[model samples]
Every structure is written in structure tokens, then in C-alpha cells.
Target: MPAEWEPHEGTWLSWPRREGISFPGRYDAVPALWRAMVTTLATGEHVYVNVGDEAQEAEVRAVLFGHEAVARTALDASAATSLATTVRGDRVSLHDRVSLHRIPTDEPWCRDHGPTFLVRDGELTLIDWRYNAWGGKYPPYDRDDAVPSRIAELLGVRAFHPGIVLEGGAIDVNGRGTVLTTESCLLNPNRNPSLGRAEIEAYLREYLNAPHVVWLGAGIAGDDTDGHVDDLTRFVAPRTVVTAVEADPADVNYGPLRENLHRLRAAHDQDGRSLEVVELPMPGAVEWEGQRLPASYANFYVGNEAVLVPTFAHDNDAVALDVLRRCFPGRRAVGIDATALVWGLGAFHCATQQQPLAVHT
Candidate 1:
């Protein structure tokens, strides 16, 4: 798989359905948050939005129009100055940078459900790993599970199906032949019971074109996906990984996080080179409706020239941005408030997937 930090022709997102498990009570407020991400991303690249049908697409156009109006009204003189060439009063016009698709999905977690685009030998192919709705936690997820192959059909891209189950969020890769994943998610019998450690590792390497696989212990708390690596550790550089560290020992996450950190420190790359591990401080516990939602700085999304970090109205938001900025010196690290988004058990990265720029011969 191509490194997420690499330039993208666009990003793909599945619009949240009212019937989906995410944002159960607050569907109205969720669209604006998505619009915020859409607007930011549309400023630079194409945004392919998945809708249920033409009717839903019509609804989406209206929503985008409302968002654009509100955004223009809220912009200050400086911000307004930056947006000089504004869209005229065309109904259902937000930014003309979207390619709407009628791809039906049960939920809006695109990173896990969508295709993992990989580039090899100057060709782009969609790696469609079997998605079992995070170990069948959410039933009737047949639509989401079928999304990868559907996307390949939509874009006319060749797709390679490995047959074994895998979710995009469960693995992190450095464009340079190395991958990081968690045993908690991959080894779970709910996902692939027949596959052992060596077997699963082989599939990952072959499918991702990755030569090395670094296995971590577990993921953070309350992540319903069993244990997605995106919520724990991420690859910032080829030999560098930025992982979350829990400071409070009394917290349940402390032990698992510390163990993962220790594992990462002792871990080496494919060439047996010592891996450089950077410890990122975790945010304080964020609970809502008597449940601890998975909130971590590690779930940030890497966009073209911008790293959108998930900020939880915490002081460490700045700290996380600083660390990521150093790691991605060429990209602008901006934080988006994910307090409400994580109630859905995901943030920016989970909601988006990159459509890599294809090399033209």
C-alpha cells in the first residue's frame, strides 16, 4: 500500500446514513462536521462521496449548499480574503470538487470498509481484503463489506481480492516495505480463525507488497473494531513510528499501551535496523452516555499537504500537532475537534481513504 502521506488524487468518504449505528441521536449535527472536513479537503483535492442513490445525492447537495452559506457567513475578513473566488448563489452548490457515487453502505467508516489502494510497477490496483464488519460486531453489514469491490467497479480500477478478512484501519504501512499491525485485531478468531500468526503475516506482506510486518499487542479502549492499529500506533516515517502512551498508571489503557511501546522499542525494521519510536501522550478519558469512546491523537488523517489531527478540546492537542509537524515537515498539521465524532467510535482517518495519484505512462 502507498503511504498515506503520499499525494492523493482524491479521498473517498461514505456519507452517514440515518439508520447507521454512528451518531444515533445526533445525525443533524454530524453532517456539518463532515462538511468541515469536505470543505478543507475540497480546497485542495477531489472528494468522492458515497451516497445511497440519486435522491440521497440531491439531499447531500442541499446540505452542502447550507454548509457553504454558513461557512461564508462565519468567515472573518482575513478568511474571506483567502477565499476570493467564491461560488455564486447556485442552489445545491458547495464546492464543485466532488464526484458523487451511488454506493450503498450500512455505515460511514470508509477506511475500514473501502478499498486499500496500492501502487506497484507503475500500476494502481485496489486491494480488496475481506471486511467482516470488524468481526461481525455489526450485523447486516453486507453492504459495507462489499464496498471495496464495488468501488473498484465504480472507478474502473483493477482489484485484487485476497479472500481473507482485513480492514484498512487495522494496518499502518511505511511506503518503504514495512507494516505495523496489532495481534488483537488480526489474531482474533472473529476475523480469521483459521489463520495463524505466520499465515496472517504472509497474507499482509503479499497483499500489501510489504516485506516486513511489526506486530503490536493491542489497541486502545472502547474501540469496537476489536483492535484497529490506527487507534494505537502509526507510521510517520519509514523507520519511525509515533505511538500513543498513557501517563496515568491507574487507567486501564496504561498497561497495554506501555507494553506496545516496549514492543515497538525492541522491534526492528525488515533490514534488522533499530526502529525509532516516538511516544505521543494520550488524551484524558472521554466518556459520554456512560461509555468510554475511543479518542486518541493517533487517529489523525494524513491529507495532501495537510495532516488533520483529532483534537479533543484538550491541551495536548497542540502537543500532538507539534509532534506530527516534526514528523511531516512538509505537511500542515491541523487539528479537528473529534469529541462528537468519536461517539461514533471513529474520527477523521476512519471516515476517509486516499485514492492515490496514478502514474501516467
Candidate 2:
């Protein structure tokens, strides 16, 4: 098995275009948020984005460049920048720091569709986990499913096929020998009903190269993709996890989430050391069109210098940010307004995938 990938040199994101998948009347916000995210990321590292064609590329450039804040203004106001920029024909540079690609793809969730890059013995490999559009919840995912292989080919890396129904958001690694996941997502009948827990563990061991798997029970309420572990628990450090907690027993997630918390506290890591579990308060439930979206604080994506956390403009947003700040020392933990983004049922982590740098032995 290959070694786990390290932090990515940059992130890959798909520009949102499908109205049905993104939610009605909110398609405009998708591009805005995508641009904003890319701009913020470009300040630290490169950003590779996929667009449909010349037309779409033009749209992306207009959204990004048109809003490129003057360096001085950006440093002071931070709010003058628009997420999208003006199209410099087919290619546009965001302050000479970011690069955009116009690759055509059907879905925008690159974290699930993009290649899972890993390194072993100083060699780069790609783990192409089968994606089924979140258990076939969205149909016609042919383009999305093919993204991993395309990325692998583009990168000229060896692509390994893990013939199992796995989404990147379903698992979290500690960069050690331990992984954290929830049974509700990985064990669901839709994903791999024939595979027992032991069999699944074997698959994880073979692909992720992890010796230990810590199982948390379920995710918080409003998670459509069963219980994606990324929306509930994350391994902030080796042998340490930060889980979302709900204190009010009246809330729907209070019981199941608490049970998961208990399980995490009782678990141990690969070294047989008890896990240090931290609690992050769940943001007040967010409902749109009477449907609760999976607005979670656990879905923050870890970057080189910062952890991009999704905040729902709720009271708990500050507390969650603070908790993550404590958890990630030396890394800025900043919250991105996710009130509009969650309408698509995912956040920063789901929207981006890390292509870990090849490790030299």
C-alpha cells in the first residue's frame, strides 16, 4: 500500500453550474463563493478550477478578475474583492498567484470526484475511489465519476482503483496510522451492504494504509449523505479528534451525536493511546424551504496556513471558530459565511480536495 498524501500544494474545485444540484434561485451564490474561496486560497497556494468551455471560462474570469481587489485595498478592507474575475479570454491570473483550468465536469464536488493523491517511497500515486454521486442521490454522474481517472492521467501518476463505494468526505485521517469514520455513512446499505464491518476495515487498511480504524456512531441531523464523518468528527491531530456536540436534549441530534462522542472518547489510536476528544458546538440548525441542510462545523478544510471553517451566521459560529483555533495552533482558523453555501448541502471541505505533495524518503 502507498503512504498517505501530505498537505496539497493547492486545491481543486469545480465551478457550480447545475441549478438542480446547487438549489433553485441560488446558483449565483455558488460562483461567488467559489471565487471567494479560490481567492483566499490563492493568497497561500495555487488553485486549480474546472470549467465547462470557453464560455464558462469567460464567466469564471469575469467573476474573479472583476473583483480582484487592489493589493492595498485587499490588505485593508478584505471585503472589496469579488469572488469571480473578468475573463482574460480563456486564461486569467488572479494577482499572478492563482491559476484556473477550464476542464469540463458535470459535478462540482471535487473532493469526492478528484483523485486521492498519495505518496510512497518518494513516488506519487492516485487512489481512485468509486464515486456514485452520494449514493446515487443525484443521477447522471457519469462525468463526475470519471474525474479521478482524468486527474490521474493529467498528473501522469499511477492510478490505483479501489473498487468500492467510497466518498472522500466519509473518512478522516490523523496523518498517522489511525482513521476516523462514521458507521452511518460507510456501513449504509446504499454504499456497501454486502461488505461487513471487518471487510470494510480490510479495504480501508489496504487503500488508506491505516492500521487502526475508529468508528463513530452517526452524524448530526440534516446530513443527506447518510452520516458523512467529515460533517461530524475530524482528526485534528494524531490520536486526537474534534467532534460536534449538542447540549440541548430537546434538539434532534442531541442523542445520536452524544452517543458518537461517547464512542470516540472510549476509543484508542494505533499506539493504544486514548484519544483526546474535543467538543465543538453545533451551529443552530439551518432550514431552507423547510428542509434542514447539513450545516456542520466539522466540515472545515485544513490548508497550509489556515483552516477554512464554514460558519452559518449562528451564535455558535464564534465558539466553533475558537475551538478550532485552539485545536490548530500556528494555523489561522477563519470562518467563511456558509449560510448561502450550505443550500447545496456541503461546505468548504466537501468543495475542495487536497493533492498531497509527494514525500521524499
- Assess each prediction's global lDDT (C-alpha) against the native: 0.83, 0.76
- Misplaced by over 4 Å in model 2 are 1-6, 18-20, 70-96, 359-361
Q: Which 10 consecutive residues of model 2 have the lowest summed lDDT?
A: 71-80
- lDDT for 236 (candidate 2): 80
What C-alpha root-mean-square deviation, in Å, does candidate 2 show against the real structure?
Answer: 3.9
Candidate 1 C-alpha lDDT tens digits along 1-361: 8888888988999999877888889777677667656765665678899999887788887776544343433233333333324333432234567778889999999999999998767777898888878998888889998898898998877999889988999999988788999999999999999999999988888888787999999888899988899999999888899999999999989999999999999998878998999989888899998898899999988888667788887778778988998999987676667787898999999999998887941
* Residue 248, model 2, lDDT: 86
True-structure RMSD, every candidate? 2.9, 3.9
Q: Could you tell me every candidate's TM-score relative to the true structure?
A: 0.93, 0.90
Local error of candidate 2 at residue 304 (angstroms): 0.5
lDDT of 2 at 33: 72
Q: After superposition, how far is residue 267 of candidate 1 from its true place, in Å?
A: 1.2
TM-score of candidate 2 versus the correct structure, residues matched by position = 0.90
